[model samples]
Target: MTFQLAACAEMLWRDRPIDWRASRLKELGFGVGLWNWPAHDIAALERTGATFTIMNGYLQGRLADDEGADMLLKSARETAAVGKRLGVHRLNLHGTGLGDGGIPVWQHDKVTGPMWLKARDTLNRICDLAEELGVTYTLENLNLMEHPGCPFNTTADVLTLVSSVNRPQLRMNLDLYHTQIGEGDVIRWCQKCLPWIGEVQVADNPGRNEPGTGEMNYPAIAKALKAMGYSGPVGLESNAEGDPEVALQAFRNAFTV
Candidate 1:
């Protein structure tokens, strides 16, 4: 079976306008993925008529404190409005706010018991908001090297949080790129995260470029996903190694099991 293929417009065609990138992805028969919504032309994006699979769910927030939780809920509510306006399928979130260079705004050297409890509570509240808004939100995993000190940034940590909550409105973004960097057992992680996965994102390790440009064997990974019955959205959240179209075609080829 073929997966629902999409590409992060923000990562590709950087020299082009955002709408132009979205339009090109659409014309190429792929859905679009976005980053922060405020940086783009909403009207122009709407005109493109691309199927927006997912985008950042919050502008600024954290998941492990009262003050951060409040900020998270407020930001999520505001972003949900934009998500609904664009008819985006899923809204994505991280453990906390990421700053310049993808570093966590709030850093934690070690997560404590109370922090874990608070993070789960905050996610439950996020689910409540999602149910109210008639939208789904995904908690994404980030690697330590790129996003040091970020809490709940591991695949295991993200899975634990989402599974503990066990709500449909909240699910795992299941980014294999980060998992490959942090934890090498990609197929096993896929099996563990299968039930609660909202979407599966991909980029090769060592370079953060399209599938074949690095160490990960994406075609094998794709076949594994099909075997596990995860025929959901698979997004190429990678930069083009060369031509954007060529990179996207490589992504499509990898997942076309």
Candidate 2:
């Protein structure tokens, strides 16, 4: 895969000046990832000459009755509409939590069972809306260490969701840092899920900071990605230690693609 560095808007909007961020990203040849921005801010992003690779679709419990699910879906559609207007394509979504009741059968039980069937139905509905809006929806695997409630924490979880949804546009966003924390074998898991992989986020392990700062062997990871025939952006969704340029340079050296 041709690697592309993408800055997450979360830290940029917090520590750095916004205008400087746009200019820096343009100079560094990086794309952008919109986390949680208002509509007007999204409009402003369109003017920055940066392509949005993916976005936060929704944030709530995964259960059917969660009010946040509906609200997030509405917001996801609106955000995706804005992204389409700006020539962006992928939208990232989180999985449901294991409520006080228990983990859903889809995550903990057989994939062909009734509970999973219901979850697949809900995912299909969401995928249908995403298709109508002309955007690809990618379900992300979160780190259980960071997010204990996240149901889809392993590559198996992601695989099951993709297989159950069984739609061309429904894919998975493989975050390397999360994989390191949540799965026993990251490279093997990537190989197994290659067909369903869509967008990818990369950062070193332990700190979720730039590569070389933490324990992840990014060069091996990049090679593994290429071996799996992944030809997409390796989004830089980590924190910069000193200057953003330092992190950018580290990414360039590590990937060397």
Candidate 3:
């Protein structure tokens, strides 16, 4: 079986329009991961004959409060609408940012319990919307050091969220970059998190650059996922070490199964 690779559009080809990003990646025989893109540009993306696999929907919001969780639900609804129209199935959202008193939502706090419950409710409702819209809502994990105050940090935490929600439409986006930083042993981590993983994002550890620029063994990571029967697109979500094309070439060479 063949798996796909999606380039993080915003992280590459800075000298062109949003539509051109996909076209350029297509020229390199690559797909794209969408973020901060307008729904109007979907036609332009389609014109490039590009493949769009995952889109970042909501980045920051409180999941525990009624007002905040409502905001997230509304945002997710809008994102699902746009993504469904564009034929994109995966809509990735960060669980939470920071809460009151500048405390992380995933950490011990006064409102953690209530907020967690609310996050659960909000995600479940979003899953309902996503199921109806023929889309999937993937909760993405971030690192504690890099993304301070990020709610979903550990791989286990993200897995717990998906398991707790218990919705077919709700899943996990295992960003290996963050995992490498927060929790090492990516190959084993990938295996453990395989069941709930709906999307995958990659970047080298130590430095958030292309695969070959840092300490990560891209070939091994790729091979591990493939061996586990994961056929979903693995997104290269990092800045180029030098030229984007060269970076892509290195990735292609290293990550091929």
Question: What lDDT would each prediction earn against the true structure?
Answer: 0.95, 0.69, 0.77
Q: Which stretches of candidate 2 lie over 4 Å from their true place?
A: 59-72, 97-115
- The best candidate by lDDT is 1
**Which is the winner by TM-score between candidate 1 and candidate 3?**
1
lDDT ranking from best candidate downward: 1, 3, 2
lDDT, candidate 2, 126-227, per-residue tens: 788887877788888876666655555567877888877779878888887888888758788888888888877888877778889988888888887876
Candidate with top TM-score is 1
Q: Taking the tens digit of each residue's C-alpha lDDT, what string does model 3 give over 1-257? A: 25677788878887778788888887888888887455447667767767778886654555656776777777777777767666776888776644453346555313366666877888888787777778887888878786576665578778877889978888888989988888889899889888888888898977788887888998888888888999887888877857888888877776788
Estimate the TM-score of every prediction. 0.99, 0.85, 0.89
Give the least accurate 10-residue stretch of model 2, judged by summed lDDT.
Answer: 101-110
CA RMSD per model (angstroms): 0.7, 4.3, 3.3
* Candidate rank order under TM-score: 1, 3, 2
Candidate 2 residue-pair clash tally: 2
Clashing pairs in 2: 1-231, 62-96
